[model samples]
Target: MSSIKWPKKRLKRIVRCKYGDSLSKENREKGDVNVYGSNGVVGSHNKSISFGKTIIIGRKGSSGSVHFSENSCFPIDTTFFVDKTTTKADIKYLFYLLGLLELDKMNSDSAVPGLNREHAYSKEVLSPSYTEQKIIAKYLDKTCASIDTIISIKQKQLELLEALKKSIIHKAVTQGLEDSVEMKDSGVEWLGKIPRHWKAVKLKRISKIQSGLTLGKQYSGNLVKRSYLRVANVQDGYLDLQDVSTISLPKKTAAGLELKKGDVLMTEGGDLDKLGRGFLWEGQIEKCLHQNHIFAIRPIKSKLMAAFLTLITTSSYGRIYFEATGKKTTNLASTNASKIKAFPIPLPSKKEQGEIVDFLNKKTTQIEKLKKNIIKQIETLELYRKSIVHECVTGKRRITDNDLKE
Candidate 1:
């Protein structure tokens, strides 16, 4: 028989979602009990509010999301929960049904958006018999687990690919391309050793650090307006010039700040890994300037090649140096012009610098292509998993005893 012919019932008749109690960080005693928030397990506590199998529904924050706990758990005030005692429906079946409803989409229009229980209770669904509900849940449990395993394998492959790329770049920039070259101690612990012929010198010796134009300053007379680059416009190896903004500045100050071809741009700070993220400017935008948060390093033509400088600064060595020296808060790290000028550069001959840059450009391109292919496969698998859950819970796909046997 078609699922459309099944008896109709409101969700409230099958289950009741109770409000979770408030548990603050100060009061929480750590133990084995899972402490849940709007998303899922946030921490562990010494006590649990609900016992046995339970379904947690997000009330705010990640509103409409669902989480299942096999044993007792404490659901914080940001969520609501239902257990065996609160529902006549099969616990697993209700979990699948709620997922199909996409509760996150039914958000309230309050200042801090939340889910209203009244709206959720009014949602009508097909009511199958007790025995059939268990059967549907059983089928989904097996099928979804199989799909999840495949996704996990694909995700691992992506991590491996990224690690491989980082390793390749780290090796080329720190050690010269020639394997037979004599080695000398770089003195810097994180930098280890380098080619015997290279010199370890301060960046200020070979490059002029030009601070960008600071925003929000009031000019006394008619000021010239020009497009400028923000930290967002620059990535590790490339520029995103599509949405560049314009700023007003004194004509002389604007001219001095104009980005030149082969000038390397670097950000002051962000996340630990993103500190000093930068790219060399190829003069993509005409008369473009950069914001104060970004530093433009112009290499002295005879001493350093811009391409080589960009590669070393974006490599693993640069990341290590920035992270170690940058002044850090709990979530972000930053460096100032003085720190940037003092950066140590592992100097290679001008001829050798160009060779290393060319080699890395070709190798990194190949790794990126492979990564894009795997990412696409993972996206497709996730969509398929969602469709399967929706189909089974809604009875669009019926499960028979013989089907489970296979």
Candidate 2:
């Protein structure tokens, strides 16, 4: 810690934030110059907006976000560009200092969020000597880079965990736990092989695909209100249930739509990967009706278990089937009840199904626990990175050429 009293100065006196020029898709010529938006590099262009190293501040959209470019780049209309020529302070030091200001909070109240430059200019910052500024920046450049590397490693661990979970589920559902069992070709392309005793059956043969009630329908007679699950409430492998909304419907209609325990809930549309992705609903909420966009697959007690079917539907086999059968647009894909009813399910005896479900449940739980621990580690590293940058830039932690040696 240093006892030096750094001079306080208005932000405008330390650096000038120049308005970035608009470069639309139609006009941009492809080159090495990075085209910067408010957040970061968005595209490439032939011409450079600023020479050498520069700091880009988000002016609109991702308002107030800070990005550093080591090379000459074009900052688009949605950003503010600053370079060595615009600041008396070391440009690198200014980048770290501006990040600590929380300029994102100074965004104007509008339909589209935007940062007001005047509000940013009015804020005060501690001004250190130019020499100290470079030292702090150099130290931070090293420190933050180290933190980022750790974060990246943790992120890769999370990815591997997810891939492991998916792999386990796919193998368990498609190939039975008994390795010695005789195998046969499952006619379904995605579902390549299965045990000899197992039979490939359409989902509708073993379960009923129940379509939910439509919203905004004008109903006659007395209206009864009940909580309903929408597409948003049903996530890939679990129900969010945090903000269950209510809808008004006739008591008869509401009763028919009420969710039963052991129903597999799946969304009808969204991103291609999200289509047909869902988990089994265990009657978490009583008297809950679901929207038309969500399909509740009620498995026949005699033939299917919701948990077992849920595993099959969430596996790679299900993903491939849904993507192949689903109607596609540019970015969105959807499946109707007819398509869902035709979903191929590997049918084993009740005993085998229960055993598979139990095995998968234990495996997935362990994977999820590992994922949570890794996520927490990443969050901690990010927080520490932010705190250290703030302290060094504000002179709370003084760095010198000698400190760099340590």
Candidate 3:
């Protein structure tokens, strides 16, 4: 667009890069120099892969992401680093050009999912004159930095909103909607203070806990193919029943394990943070049962409500209890029926529970709606960023002083 006739050049003539060593993440000692993988910096080390302008390209997993660092970098074997000295191209411009190519989807090796260096070399790129290239690169650097700053601020807002949601839930559940209500110690250290009208009751006293049967080939007894829930189906405060699968179970056994309309489904075990995650089951299917890895908590007392129970379990109180009491292995943890029953929950009046549930449902829906809008804004900004890069690098958009001023 700037009157510099873009010339086609074989990648090998303008780009130079090579493979690195097999330094896996666990083996390396931590240091100051960044270790570049295909997508970005994976870790840091005292030693560097190369000095000066380096463009790291994914050679295997997360293939084709283009990353450029001005200083020295160590790109691991799963990546390729192009030498800046060998090419007449502007390094920044080339990096933008690589992103437009979407090379990660061009994985050539079927078995290992790798980028063939020969395939990369055989491709052609449109080259702009040096002065025009610098103009375009400089304009984008300024524009993108400003856009990134906005994105960073928006991301922080999203994080703060999440924390605020947690605080609101904690206050509404523990302190009660009426601030004038007298407070008392919950006896549980995490639950420092609760409303005077509330009573801390062990889950076993208020609810009946049951786990589902594990499906296998040998089972017989009017075996019927029916849908069942696993850990994946139960998420924090909600169920994801979009991809339910079927299994063979005895009709009697399946009936015994069947979920009801008001049943609360919870994950038995998973990542440490994943424990105690669950939601209400609204009878998504007629003949569905959960797996052994999931727990079904049915209310035995009128004080407990399914929606209220979900909020409490997914709240900070539930997470803290699981982290401290659940049997933990490394980063993974699980809770058995006994442990789950032992959990303490604050019992409020049925009316108060319903009111709290309604209030939270309305508030969280607003927060979630706001969050979705912010997320869409971020997505739009990212798409705009990509469009600018493509337009400039591919010669669709011309760069001028007026453009730079804008």
Candidate 4:
């Protein structure tokens, strides 16, 4: 086995500056990349800084994220700037190496997580020759770029599949399976057609929509250790119990508004695209109560499957209805009880509805599995990129320009 060694040295000669007093109104202008502190480029400014080919390390908020810019730019006070004199390190090699470091692990917990430059510079680093450094950085740039391209293609494929799934659901619910089936005019303006025997009815006809309980500030103190469901618990099409919180509420309140199995929960307001995100309650938690930001839809009949309604409400057709009726406030919009109740639904026979739900369950499950596999492939590619960078930068692996030619 071949062994490679990295020399240990003090990064003593590097010039460092904490991002502060670097911007003046005279020097600053709009449209230039404004180097933010921890949160990244929060805004843009025309002002430039003295650091050339340097690495900017976020000190607070987003500690340890390293950004390398070839041109002059302003660095915010929450960031630490490193210039060319920083040891004998190759700027590109160090940038790539820093990318591999999980800097979040080093954050000091105070009012906000932060990094101290003195402590950061004192940390140990493996060093290789400048020529070897360039070779490794160049190889990584090319290889990872290629891998990223493939991942991008796969991601687009996933998006296309999602669109196709929505199209299928929209057609199945609105037009039914039989292409030759006679279409009756849907009385509603947005709904163009319905199966000959199907009825078009308002959502109010089949379900009662009510917002969840508004736990007052006093209720915050009485939170119990039992599982509590909040707006975050409700995801796009399902409930995520991974980070469920425990809050205490009066037993009466819990019993009065507690969620049950087969209940459909929807977000009252959120990002415009997520305003009406709804999901079926699979009964993951016992005696769970929802926050006021969620709405519970209780069906009138056992024939109305919560899962089928949830699918319809989250479908493209449902999203259009939600967007049309939702009241916009800034970036968020909400669908009130009246609007939700007035929303139109295409009613098919209970048997046909069950068949459609079963068919979609099988198809969507397969698509979701494929999506998960593609996501894993993207993660593996990222790990491989990091490994290649580590090995090449540490001299364990070597790449030459001639290798690139081959």
Error of 2 at 11 (Å): 1.5
Global lDDT scores for all candidate models: 0.87, 0.89, 0.82, 0.73
Q: Cα deviation of 370 in candidate 3 (Å)?
A: 1.1
User: Local error of candidate 2 at 385, Å?
Assistant: 1.5
Against the hidden true structure, what lDDT does model 2 obtain? 0.89
Model 2: per-residue Cα lDDT at residue 298: 96
Q: What is the lDDT of residue 23 in candidate 3?
A: 81
- The per-residue C-alpha lDDT of model 2 at residue 128 equals 84
What's the CA error at residue 331 for candidate 4, in Å? Answer: 3.6
Q: Candidate 4 lDDT, tens digit per residue, 1-406? A: 0124657543433334355444544555776665555665656686656356767778877888888777666777777766664446677677787776666567776778887666665656666667667767677778877888998998998898888888888888778777899989989777788888988888788887756767555564454545667887887666778987666676666686778887788887777787666788867788887777788887766456676687778677788888887899866787777787787888887888888888888888888888889889888987887787777656676666675653
The per-prediction tally of clashing pairs is: 0, 0, 1, 6
Cand. 1 Cα-lDDT: 0.87
Which runs of model 4 end up more than 4 angstroms from their true locations? 1-5, 10-56, 68-88, 217-227, 242-253
Residues 71-94 of candidate 2 have per-residue lDDT tens digits of 989999999999977887888888
Q: Point out where model 1 deviates above 4 Å.
A: 109-113, 116-119, 231-245, 282-285
Candidate 3 on 255-276: residue-level lDDT in tens? 8889888878878788888688
Best by lDDT: 2
Question: Pairing residues by index, what is the TM-score of model 2?
Answer: 0.93
